[model samples]
Target: MVELQAATKLDAVFHALGDATRRHMLRDLAGGERSVGELAAPFEISLAAASKHIKALERAGLVRRTVAGRKHLCRLEARPLEGAHEWLGFYKQFWSGRLDILESLLRQEDAAKSQGEDHD
Candidate 1:
């Protein structure tokens, strides 16, 4: 059995998503369930290479697999990602306040520029 701390789950999710190939795989899985072949169709990599990336995602708990006959179907398991969202929410409020201040400063600058132009 595998378990991740709530605090550390975001780190795991972001680290697994750092790869371009894995990002593409995630986009495809977002549309619906897919087999490894369907997920690998757009890429030029070998099946073995794609499988390695999939394994990383599986370990991170972002993807779940169900084996049927000889095929494995991969589905998105997004509950783990809520940890990432919760982490980001903290920074969002801080940034929005900073951006609001910047917007006011910019407006003042623009008003001063227009006043100077009127004199010219």
Candidate 2:
């Protein structure tokens, strides 16, 4: 089903996002495209390690890469993140509703307690 495939793809996106290094790379790409070397500059990782991270992002559909001769140019492909955001938005709404109910109950209980103290 399409939903299953979307969930599977979202799983890959979350796995890719689970790493701080890949997240930073995505943030860098958000500004515009950059060479693999440019993406790897801030970290102490070897080029190979950076490539592995980029490959993961590519697999998640979070980044697009193009080869220009010997250089690998990478750019953010953020559409997959929109899917992830949509998935999280469902839970956000669910929790927000639950918290709102909890806040109302607490406010009612506090008002009742104050009324009892005033009567005493």
Candidate 3:
């Protein structure tokens, strides 16, 4: 049951990350907390649309929102991304190993080809 819940949350986090706008918003927050308007300034999106993006990030635990008078400030909450990072790290290692093997094989092939050319 706990595993299932974790998987669900991971799904939500990926879903939130799947959008470019939300990803950029997270990048902006990484610098520091920003008001919704500040976040929206880089794009031509309406505040409502920006809020919707932010709400998705909130649901994924990627961003925390605090009310400051008229401003809705959002700060980056990166802990949830630890799961995603771990997941990607696994694949990164896998691919790195595969690429290393491929590089070695290619180098061997090139060495053989050079030797053959030297004989001719």
The candidate that achieves the highest TM-score relative to the unseen native structure: 3
Q: Least accurate stretch of 10 residues (summed lDDT) in model 3? A: 62-71
- The Cα RMSD of model 3 versus the native structure comes to 1.0
lDDT of 1 by residue, 1-120 (tens): 134575466677888889999989988999999999888889998888888889988977999989899887899988877877787888999999999999999999999999999999
Give the Å shift of residue 38 in candidate 3.
Answer: 0.6
lDDT of 2: 0.97
- Per-model TM-score versus the true fold: 0.84, 0.92, 0.95
Give the TM-score (vs. native) of candidate 1: 0.84
Predictions in order: lDDT: 0.87, 0.97, 0.97
Assess candidate 3 and give its TM-score to the true structure. Answer: 0.95
70-99 in candidate 2: lDDT tens per residue? Answer: 999999999999998998999999999999
Q: Give a tens-digit lDDT track for model 3, residues 1-120.
A: 999999999999999999999999999999999999999999999999999999999999999999978989999999999999998999999999999999999999999999999999
Displacement of the residue 45 alpha carbon in candidate 2, Å: 0.4
lDDT-better candidate, 1 vs 2: 2
Ranking by TM-score: 3, 2, 1
Q: What is candidate 1's CA lDDT for residue 92?
A: 100
Name every residue pair that clashes in candidate 3: none
